[model samples]
Target: MQLHELEVENYRAVRRARLSFGHTTVLIGENDSGKSSLLEALVRVLDGGAAEEPPNFESFQFHRDPVKHEIVGPIRIRIVFREREAGEWAGEVYAPIHDLLLRAGEDCREVAFELRAQPEGEVVWRLKSGKRKTSDPEVLRWLREFTPAIHLRAGMLTGYGTETLPCAPGLCRTGETELDEKIAAIEVAAERLISKTSPNQESDLEAGFKATRELLQLVTLPRDRKAPNLARRVREILGKGIDLNSSQPTLPGSNTSSEKLGILLLIAALLRVARGAMAKEMEPIWIIEDPEAHLHPKSLASISYFLSDIRWQKIITTYSGAMVGSMPLSNVRRLTRRRGVVTEHRVDVTQLSGVELRRIGYHLGAHRGAACFARMWLLVEGESEMWMLPQLARLCGYEFGVEGIECVEFAQSGLAPMIRVAEQLGIGWHVLADGDKAGQTYIDTIRRTVATKDRQGRFTLLNEPDIEHCFYKHGYAKVYQEHARLGGKSTRDMDPRRVIQRAVQTLSKPDLALRVIEAVAADGSPGVPDVLQKMIRTCVKVARSQSK
Candidate 1:
């Protein structure tokens, strides 16, 4: 069951925003964007408060100074649940959900929720102020009186170091219960493998016998079939009577300490799995904060796949693009915060090109395979190129990734952050840049990044200040392959070299030489020179609209 959509009003940094979330949503943004704030609100509203508990609003950052005298206001959280019948997504639109539902509505399905605030900033999730003496709100009264659910920590995995977990006992790395479960499962798995080698039971007899005995002992039952002579009879059957008496065995084994720790870790995992089984409602949406933190690349990859299977609608937060790229494209959520109110967006990778392509490349590599991926990287100036160049590479039909050809738009602010992230990712990179003089500075910055590579293989810098120039320089042989659908021949003669000439000819802002370049590159068809010239004028109008 999914909390298909959210409508929050005047809650924390989010004053009023309505959003639709996929079953598995990856909530991402720079720091202090309302990602966490949004989750907290949902958890509280979903919790269906039992007793009066005031929401702590101290941490909420406001875009405006709320009236000091105000209180007793309404903060509404509306979650829509979708019902799917057979292959189609059906519907029974409920206001507030009682619990998570896979296909909408409780099995006995009843849904209505209402919450109100108090004058002193002590928001009463249920209802009432004695002076007002009104009856409890109908919606809140029903939910509070009849059905309710446990509000999970929006992020159960918040702190990186603390071992405490929310699900169950022995879930912590050092928990004992987890260890026992692991030891049992491991024995089962290992013996299953061992049984393969010893089809006749000669090689695995002792181990299998031990496992059977231990498993029996774990549940405090007797596997020996003899009640009185428990230890003695069991030991004799395994042919280890002497060692049993000595309280030690002579056998190849993993260290007890290591195995014990491993068991605890195993149990912790099992407990989390069990949490779903035990939930009173639908399987929970596991909210995670940087699940990639402090884990090995291989482990992170495995975990990434596991998380993808969680099936619970999720909201994963991260500061690292590695985690972002490791995630599927459909799940790439980009939360944008402006002024003080926070909003969300899906990073539509399809619209990105050139530099944006590289950013995504870094994101994919960093998220999936390595926390620390390729070194020295190229930082592009825009997101569009990052979005499309993989298409460019595909058009050229060159297989890209395996050859270590990774690139990403560093960030549009400047080449500085891009270079820094590359340095952090430990990859040396060459940059393809715009033709303007300022771009030279970006080029110099990138050249310095690969200062260490063997001088010959040092850095591969490819520049065409603009793709048009790139089109201009490499037009003959590859142009057809790159923009294959281009119906016309190259219009190199009409190409504008300087920003000023194109600006003067095109009534548009002559200031942006790049616009003229874009116009020429838009078409490669014959007799398209008129369109190219017109494109310059169109681009100028576009620039004017943008400035306005």
Candidate 2:
């Protein structure tokens, strides 16, 4: 069974949200955007009742209306579970709820239940299927056991010890008999010692205790009872201790760094989940928060790979770009909060072909995955624009990093895929294409691909053939002339365009861009080009408007 979807209402910061899940779903958003709250809601609804005491729904768990300044009640969390195959229902764990499973589509069955917490603090669970609803505790129990949800909070790896390895069930199974025998031997020795120290023994102390017992016959005296055996309690503490194979045999949490411990814990959890599934004992769902916390980039990639390889349904919340880049764009759900309501956005991979999807994934997962997190994307042709445009934006008093604007170089990866991603995610984008034939092709592609209502303020074409030519045309002729002279070429009578083109061909694109930016910064004679300045302003305006 896999978690299919979650629908939440008036839960903490989320006024209402409906999110669908993939096998390995990643939740990403800004701080306080309700990523943690969403995970908490799932944990509460799935495992709340399993505890010895019922979970208390605190007042703050209810959503507060930003405008009204009042808290709302009756928080609702509904979850849907889909069977992986028709035979999954035949398993003994799911047999009790087999009749309640609803037909989702052809050959697909699903079961849904809602957890509602009323204002008066009463929580109720109702199973829903095709007009038949019931508050069956049996269904809830079956659901909890069939797919147990485990939440690993941020920084939890450091708190674990060798005796309590998260994956001990799968990792340790060989030393039980030896441990039990040793514990029994110790218990026997402790019993012998207790007998020798007992007050019931016929010693001088026993005689004194008997005399006292005669005087206080109504009260129970210590002489009549044997001593308690304290060694029996050692059985609970003496089990297999996991050795991490370091210089010193110690637990990961005690000796290892947080980053290494995180990786180890994840590997252990994956093993346990896999083994449990195969043994038909349990199918656990992991809710991991910030698996990339304090992890290096390489370590982050390792965790991402582990997550992708695991077959069990898991949800991860992360704020790392490298982590985001490692995941498929289709599996990521971007969250945003506006007007006290949390909303989710995701790429509609259905619109992409197999080839296009692979291409996009390769580019994003390899290099440009961070673009998905940007509020706006400035699509450029190549590295020249990627490097130069941000500097220009800075001169215009708009910093791309601070403004959450990512300059995506779309030369290697085509523009259509990026446009599709941006449109689906509601990220404002502006394409800066040159004025040559290729540039015109990009413009035509945008017109054909983008919606009519979304075309405004989304593209800018340079008046010149390229950025280099634009610099020469827009009163920055001296910038290139100086470069030509420095390169041992006299541009006394050459065309300004030719001079700039030669400089572009002589120096690498990035190096030449750096030279131009340096010259512009040093001389301060020709400020930012008018067209480029306007383009930056337009991008900022579009980005801000879309954010609102």
Candidate 3:
């Protein structure tokens, strides 16, 4: 079964929010933006509280109004699950709840699980099928058995014992009746031994006491006693015998890094599923938080590949840029909060054609995925602006990193796909274009892509032909003049623009940009160009507005 959708109300930072899911969903957001809360909500309702004790409704778990600072009541989390394929729900485990599966569409079956906190500080779990609803705990048990949730928290597998592998009984059990018979015999013998060792011979004790006192008569009181639970003892014995050294070559011992240990745990879980320990009718949903923790970029890419290959439904939360870039753009869900209310922002890949989708994915995977985390995107033509814009923004008293602005050089994938992605992800974008023909094309694309009302603030055209020319025309003419003389090029009677143009053609664009920024930093006389400063201010204003 796959998680179809989730709705949360008055739970933690999420006042009210609804989220849809696919087979694989990557939750990306800043800290405390409800990512962990969402995952916790899923674990609470679907995992059947396996990983944790039953949640006591803490006051902090309730949503507090940002303005009034008063906690709310009845924290609710609802989840919907549907079959991954048609006619796959034919197992005996699904028989009891067959009637409870609601018809979603053609060959589609769905069921909803709702968990609500009551005024008396108690939690209520209910299963729903269309208009029919029941609080029967048996149905919840059936749901968990049919499709269990595997929640792997961060660092859960880092410090594991290697002497005895902690694994499912199915992993170590052999299909033989002899082991069962021997365990049963041992249980019976142990119970008899306990009975034999008890003080049952009262006559012999009285004879021994006869010498001490002749007149005193001793009596032993008859008392009822319970037998020891041999079955629980057998389970405890079996738990210590199961180990992974024989199966997993590199066991996740104390020496294993947290990153590799997580991957190993996932693989072990999958092995259990493969070995028929888990139900075969539906794959378990894996709720993993920070799978990218302590992983290198290359390792993140490898893990992403491994995760994509698994057919099970996975909900992962991450803060790593490489992790975001490695996954498909459609799988990413960006979360944001304002005034103590969380909202989700995602790209609607359904509206994009296959080619457009591919283009966006290519850009994201090409190390531009960090743009998904940015509040604003400064779309530039090439690397020169990409390298120089942030420095210039700082000169104008705007910190790009602090303000969550990313300079995306969209020369490879063109402008349309990047703009579409930014717009869909709720990231504000502004295009800085040259005055040349290629730049005019960018300007025209922005006009056609962005709404007419938003075009002026989102698009800027430099007065000169390009960045090099613009820098010369604005305030850095002397820097270029000195560079031209050092390069054996006479600039005594040359046009100032032509001099800079020759310098750009000969020197690398990025190198020249660095030189110009360094010169401006040393001089500290002429500030950033007025047009560029205005553009930066406009980007900040538009980005913050869009975020709100």
Candidate 4:
């Protein structure tokens, strides 16, 4: 089962906040806008692994964290999620977080954690640091089993520890490889640069910076900060070039290809070993943070697909909304904090209207790019209807939040698939389809398709247009008759009105009144209220005339 949402308190930059999580949630904001802090909280909440007992913000990528700036004391992190059931949302699904971590700060009490789970649901939380007087066994079990663990931060670059190059002779320009004097010689050049230009102590500054620049050009990776792994690889390679005599592929270039290929092989081999090492019983919560550290967009795209293919649940956090946009919307939510409160702007990725869908495609360099895993589907009868619905929904305070909703031409596939997908992700699904001919057919289909005994059902199929029309959208004969008598612009759009009137003709006054109110509200205009006032008077007069 997938862990579906999160909440937090006093966690680094977030003094008090809550977040709505999707399966593949993209936490987007300006750097240090509490994005990484929330991620750290997730790590602590799910896996209970915070390095510093008191939670140091600087070490976890919060450059300007108030705490890191030494302004605040110890902090806390809380995460909450429900598990996914195979068929329905009956009561609650179970996905318990295991392991609890807390670091004592200079200012706060010993962090306390109490875990509670029931047939209803489970909740895990820790109090301000208190250094428990006595340990709770249930809490201990919760920490051991439920907490989700994240093994790697997305910034890795080397095969081994950063100090490997410096320690091994001939590994750089001079001589460092323990195996060969050639590696030891290569180490000399790297050491020369490290001594001259190292950002940190005992490292080559010029060599590291040059390697960083070269990697960025090669992979389009952001160079906000330098890393030791990429730097060491660069110096050793430039010092000795590719050892084609020993290398099998016979690379085409000496400038970067060989080194790049070598690093790729190292990472690939390591990943395989790592994947294999994972226990068959251990279902890890894989969080790949900004995976584009050393690959092209195309390659990154493939990597995303690979991650999606994994059988276990994975929550990938990315800076690129476009990448998330390519995934399912049922798994997306915007992370924003206001007044020190984190509010999740939860939106279905398929919330994009027809126009927004076209615009996104344009921005992505394809008129209709189908390559991305996530897509937004637009459901409408015709182009004219699709054009007007978004405007209407917006005027009524419904902004689909514009991420990845696709506009499809038909309702059968669009409606059913949309609801089914949302059910799987445990996201809300609302069906607002056209109220025209065969409209009832679509509604009935949705009802029967998703109608189950499960509590908290995900699909909501609204019969939105019923109260507005005088007749159902079908019944052409009645529509033409009403159109001729009313002298409308045309009778084509009037058939459904006739059908609705006939359907409710024998109903009581209260029933008719309820339908009338629905119609007026749906017209969605200030003038509509006035228009409804007149339509009621007309209906009353017509009823009296029929009585006479």
> How do these models rank on lDDT, best leading?
2, 3, 1, 4
Count: clashes, candidate 3: 1
Q: lDDT winner between 2 and 3, please give it.
A: 2
| TM value for model 4 | 0.37
Lowest lDDT 10-residue stretch of candidate 1: 233-242
- Name the weakest run of 10 consecutive residues (lDDT summed) in model 4: 91-100
TM-score of 1: 0.43
Report residue 100 deviation for candidate 1 (angstroms). Answer: 16
Name the 10 consecutive residues with the lowest summed lDDT in model 3.
215-224
Q: Which ranges in model 4 have alpha carbons more than 4 Å from their true place?
A: 48-76, 86-142, 145-147, 157-277, 338-340, 348-548
Q: Candidate 3 on 341-404: residue-level lDDT in tens?
A: 7778899888788887887788877768788899899999888899899999898888998888
Candidate 3: give the clashing pairs.
165-243
TM-score between model 2 and native: 0.78
For candidate 3, the per-residue lDDT at 94 reads 69
- Tens digit of per-residue lDDT, candidate 2, span 301-397: 5456545644467798887878888778888998877755777889888898888888878887788777777889999998889889999888779
Candidate 4 on 1-548: residue-level lDDT in tens?
34554555555566556666545555544344466667766665444333213222333332224434532323444444343433222222222221122332332221234322221222333432234322444443444343345434554222223332213222222122321232222234344432344254223323333343333233222431233333332322232332322323222232343333333322332232222222223345656566555545554554454455444555666666446656654455545454345555443436556554344334332322221222223344334333433433343434333323333334323455444443433233334344455666666766677646642222222344532342232222332243234434454455555544543454433454343334434544232332223322332333233212
Residue range with the least summed lDDT across 10 consecutive positions in model 2: 230-239
By how many angstroms RMSD does model 3 differ from the true structure? Answer: 15.3
What value of lDDT does candidate 3 attain over all alpha carbons?
0.65
Which of the two candidates, 1 or 3, achieves a greater TM-score against the reference? 3
Error of 4 at 283 (Å): 2.2
Candidate 2 off by > 4 Å: 48-55, 102-105, 158-262, 265-280, 485-489
Q: Each model's TM-score?
A: 0.43, 0.78, 0.76, 0.37
